[model samples]
Target: MHESLSFLAATYVGQPIWLWLAFLAFIGLLLWIDLGVVNNKDGVVSAKKSAGMWASFSAIAVAFGAYVYFVYEPDPLYYMSPDNLNQQAVLQYFTGYLLETALAFDNIFVIGMIFTFFAVPREYQHRVLFWGIMGAIVFRAIFISLGAAIVNEFTWVLFIFAAFLIYTGWKMIFGGDHEMDLNKNPVLKFLRKRMNITDTIENHNFFVKKPDPKGSGRLVLFATPLFLALVMVEVVDVIFAVDSVPAIFAVTKDPFIVYTSNIFAILGLRSMYFMLAEAVARFKYLKYGLSMVLVLIGVKIIWNFGLYKGWKDMTGEALVPYLEPQWSLIATLGLIGGSMAYSWIKTRGEQNPA
Candidate 1:
């Protein structure tokens, strides 16, 4: 009996099996409540309701971060002192969460664009985004697992990730306007060729059986614009993950921390999307903040690597200082908050006029 219990609690990929299962169950419960209770009906979600939902999900994420601080064994392997380990793990989780949430705003922009391009109605948008979130969960899991494995094997990959982040951040700040032209999107073009699609939405159904467009006396499956919107949403997330997954890896290498933070940020994104979609144009400075975050994290990764090598060469003597996870978290929050404040003031001034 003791051996069986011990086996169930055994560590896999640096976390106990039970921990992983608990996290999964918690996420499952949230999804169930979201789809089954809070938003069971097919109706347009008002901005006020979306705001309340965002707050609820955001609070849950913060609580989970607090739970990590209190319950998790920070240094199970005893590498760092207990206090330092606890601080580092908790700080890493929050930093990863904040960074991911900030980066995810870019996704909101893309999602909004996709829905507008498809002319998706407000009520049906939730259904597409809900399914999109489901796909994101699976996709992020695979990305995180693969990323953790690769980084663990090749430590130098961190440098590459850092460099990529720097490049991406610079481009975002200086690049021309990013417009999503559905006509130019290869995925949508391909789908159009491969599937029979309807010209209009069919009451929130992704696919509906209809009389064959070819005038045959049989029913055929036709993909609705809603499904195309969902597919585009999924594809956009995959594209964004190329940057976001690496950005989080720059924060911490712990698969548990990485995965949990990523999932929590993503879990709230659908509600966040609805809440901010109509007001996206108001936050003009948000991209600058997001750009700065990526660049800061990239620099932090490189700085830490330099400190590690310098410490080794100096025979345990400290050389260059490294940016701690806590400081990184502070900087990220400041940048995001400051940018939001600036955006609000500027927009308010413009609205009122001198």
Candidate 2:
């Protein structure tokens, strides 16, 4: 296992810096076209157009993934190995991206709840999501940094995080829980009681009008409802990140790959949220599927640690377990794809019975 990790790390570390730069540049160009050119319209993205954007965004990600595989870590030396540098990079990228995107579906559910609670206007929904993503970027950066520091300083931390993942996954799969009860939400209730709130949403404003210092005009900053909802968004994201960050760490300790995969998936989340909100209700079985993934990965992490120590003591040899990474990658992909397929089929079958 150590040798395999060393080889994998070597391939990544030896990749040329220029290749990474080109990849970033391409993503930037795509962002430019998306915000500057395509999103010039004022209203919500229609379903047909949303479908197109999804296709385009996915294509860009896949193309960029291919570019990274070939340019950075092109396999050489007869190129016939079942395992090669390009294949490894692609697998890692897909695994990371899939985890981020799959978990993002949960985010859409919360966003829906937030918007409904605050009564935000349909036209301004994108703005909230845009700013929410910005906040997520900052929050995830802090989380990744803290997580890396802890994992490095204490080797046993992985076991604790793994146990938590397994527990959360099990609860999600078997607990049959949904619909967060407001009475149980202490923070939200506390904020509502403490803050002054307006009865009606004024011109899609988030807060009640307040007097400006200079007496220029009424200021419309974070209103009580908006503030409460944003808080919910941040809190929800933190919970989701707990499962996702550790899963990514299992893939590769390289911060660059982890951070980049997170960035690409998050960049598309605003559009994805709008696209998936109505459809999320149909995916009754998805939570179970995601739970299965979390348990599998958590077991893999614990097993990896145990396997390494077991081999070292028994044979006086450092061995990293074989196919652990590949199994994780394959299982993560299967859970996501299979869940979505099942959800789609169930929804369609119910709509038009056989």
Candidate 3:
């Protein structure tokens, strides 16, 4: 019993094993409630319900941030006495979570576009988003794990990550308007070429078995457009992770914090999409705001260069960047908030003509 307890208490990826297990288990419970209780039926989630769901999930993330503040051990090794969570730990977690959620605003736009391109109905969209996000949760886990490992081993990679984010941000801010042509998506093409897909979604199912036209006595599993949409969503997730993973790492190298923050932020996207799907593009300037957010996070990483050890863990060291976690959080809120408000006001003016 003691050995078992000790095993759970052992550290993994800069956090105790039990903490990881607890967080993951809690997430599993949330998903079960979503799948089994809250969203058991195939129906369009109302805007009111979607907003409520987003609020609930955001509340949970905030509460968990508090939990992290109270329980997270700065030194997982317990080298120092009472290494309970400090302001910096909580700040980093909040900053990462907020950054990820901000980035997802742009992602929701693409996802909304994907669903539109596939001509998916409101009812069937739920299943696609649920499963696609499930896949995202898994893939992002791998990406975060690999990322944390790489950054921990080679800190110089922070510079590389910063450079990539800044370059991408610049492109986003200056890049001419680009539209997604789903027909040109390589993943979609590959899936289409390989799978015998139906012209339309079938009873909200991703696949349906049909008798092949080849005069065989066997049924072949045919993928539906539903499945194709799910694939596109999954593909989009991988593309976005390249930015979000590094953006989070710019704040902290702890895999546990990164994983938890990223997942929680993603949990809100399904609801956000439901609430804003048909209207996300109306907020024209929001994209620029999110792009600037990426730039802010990137610039935060590059602040003070290597002179202050900016990206290092703040647990025991005083070498944290000059732009501290609190400042990052504040600036992040400002950029996201200001851009959104500005976009809202401008969009309303165009609609109202004064």
Tens-digit lDDT string for candidate 3 (222-321): 9998888888899889988988998888877768788889999999999988887766756778767778777877787677445454434444454643
Provide the lowest-lDDT 10-residue window in model 1.
Answer: 74-83
Judge candidate 3 against the unseen true structure and give its global Cα lDDT, from 0 to 1. Answer: 0.82
Off by over 4 Å in 2: 1-37, 71-89, 182-197, 204-227, 317-321, 349-354
Q: lDDT rank, highest first?
A: 1, 3, 2
State the local distance difference test value for candidate 2: 0.69
307-350 per-residue lDDT for model 2 (tens digits): 76557769977587545355767898788789978877888747
TM-score winner, 1 or 3: 1
Could you tell me which 10 consecutive residues in candidate 3 have the lowest summed lDDT? 76-85
Give one clash count per candidate, in the order shown: 0, 2, 0
Candidate 1 residue runs with Cα over 4 Å from true position: 1-7, 75-83, 214-216, 310-314, 349-354
TM-score of each: 0.93, 0.78, 0.91
